[model samples]
Target: MTSEKKTYNFLIAGVPYKLKTSHDDATVEELVEFVNSRMNQALGVTKNGSYQNAAVLTAMNLAEELILLKRKAHRELEKLEEKALQLSMDLENSKSNKVLNN
Candidate 1:
């Protein structure tokens, strides 16, 4: 796989940080833009005081959300796989029955 380094700038707790990650050129820019927007919103929420702590809390919340999303995605994938397997078995059984009838 081809890896390209991309730089993303975002605000965390009113402080700006640049993050560099290796990703495909096409999608990395979009990911960077999204990260910047989310960081800005989180920073805005904690503008009054203790920006650093607020940023940390925001990161924790985002991480938890990601974990839950992953779990949900895995469950959906499992269900789809089971459905596919059942379909394949049914197809095979149908073919065998047709052959027996002939």
Candidate 2:
């Protein structure tokens, strides 16, 4: 189903922004808060940095966090796949052993 995008007005790093998104009001507000927090942290680290620089740094930091999370998730999925394979092999061996003893 197609839904109309709604305008969400928010402030980040003291600057006002308007976004057209399908997200609910609360989700937009939460994202705005996250962006502001990231930018503030960037500014804190680079005391003399401009707003643009802080914003860029914040983006880089968030990207890094996303990449690390993706990597961790991939590793976990690999582990689960290996465990499943092992369980399948164990089940097959048990079935064969039961037939041999019968």
Q: Where is model 2 more than 4 Å wrong at Cα?
A: none
Clash counts for the predictions, in order:
0, 0
For residue 48, model 1's alpha carbon misses the true position, in angstroms, by: 7.7
Q: Give per-model CA RMSD.
A: 3.3, 1.9
Tens-place lDDT per residue, model 2, 30-91, is 88889999998998888687898898899999999999999999999999999999999999
Model 1: colliding residue pairs: none
Best by lDDT: 2
lDDT of 1 by residue, 17-72 (tens): 77787766556667656655666676667756466655676677789999999999
For model 2 the local lDDT of residue 52 reads 84
In model 1, which range of ten residues has the least summed lDDT?
8-17
Q: Candidate 2: what lDDT?
A: 0.90
Q: lDDT values of the candidates?
A: 0.74, 0.90
